[model samples]
Target: MRRINGGGVIEETCPSWCAGDHQDDQATDLDDLAHSSTVTALQMRVNAAAPSPLLSAAILQSPYEDVTSERVTPRAPYVVFAPSDDDFTIELDADGLADVIAQIRQHADRLVQVRNQLMALRTGMKGTAAMSDGL
Candidate 1:
């Protein structure tokens, strides 16, 4: 497929989830030539005390080494995690993703423990308050 911005013909087959070529042909830098899949909202929170803002996940790919002589190594498609406001973005490969998954599970378990402790504390406080009212 031809790049819309006159970057030339794209040799790589588009991934099934890719939203199509959004890259600008006029972009002078290779990093600007990238393709992205449809964004998905992630059900996650950065802070437990505050309401979670929208987090998004999508597959992203820049021009591979085969397409550009500037790159030393072949570029691989990676998962991009970004916030709704696009303040920052994190790119991860398979191994990095695995580590993140493991850490998330561990943190989630810890959060559950904290929640249980908070519930118990609330119950104890309620009991003490009730006893004081009767006194």
Candidate 2:
């Protein structure tokens, strides 16, 4: 993506039949997405890169639904918790990690206070043991 007029621009080659000096009018409106930049650039890149033979074979072996449907859209400052056969991962953005750490520390402080209360109760019970032994 190249910056032009303080925003990103993606340029692509058009086929001769699709070419015109002022062909911006041929665009279809897709909501929220900048159609001229994002969608057309993706199509152009996919068309330009020929798939490897092994990749093509693997895609064929996979389910048909896998080819037609993909719903993952990634953004900055996100998390991905992925688990596999042998391993798992919990990936978080820097700010998210900081927030988690803060929450853990806050809970840890409460846990320490509860533990001290339990210890104090045990000490009070031990005084009864000392008195019984004296009697």
Candidate 3:
């Protein structure tokens, strides 16, 4: 995976055919560093913009039937839940994680409320124990 970064001026080897210009000056070390740096920078940029190797491999191995075969463009599903919170059948990206976290937080609030209600009811029931003893 690679990305063409700013300026699109890939400072790569000027091509072997153009080596006549550098026959003098003993610039071997400088040339090596320049080429290596250019390659390294390109690699870094590509890795930053594109998906990781594991994700790429997963996409490549995906079943053919899963892809839309029709000529018409496929629309995204009408998302009932937020993208961050949806539990996808497939592996989710970073955006998915954010949604999932949001959903978890939302549900946690509800659970806390229910728990508080239950505790309050339990406290109320404690008084009934003494009344039952009198019976």
lDDT per model, in order? Answer: 0.67, 0.39, 0.36
Candidate 1 lDDT, tens digit per residue, 50-120?
54545566877775435553423346788876656457877777776677778768988999999999999
Give each model a TM-score.
0.66, 0.35, 0.33
**Could you tell me which residue pairs clash in candidate 1?**
5-25
Q: Of the pair 1 and 2, which is ahead by lDDT? A: 1
Off by over 4 Å in 3: 1-88, 132-135
- Predicted candidate 2 versus true structure: per-residue lDDT over 1-135, tens digit per residue: 223343445443433332234243223221122211111111113466763221010001111123233323222223332222223445545565567568768987999999999999999899989999999
Return the TM-score for candidate 3, rounded to 2 decimals: 0.33
lDDT (C-alpha) at residue 76 in model 1: 74
Top TM-score prediction, candidate number:
1
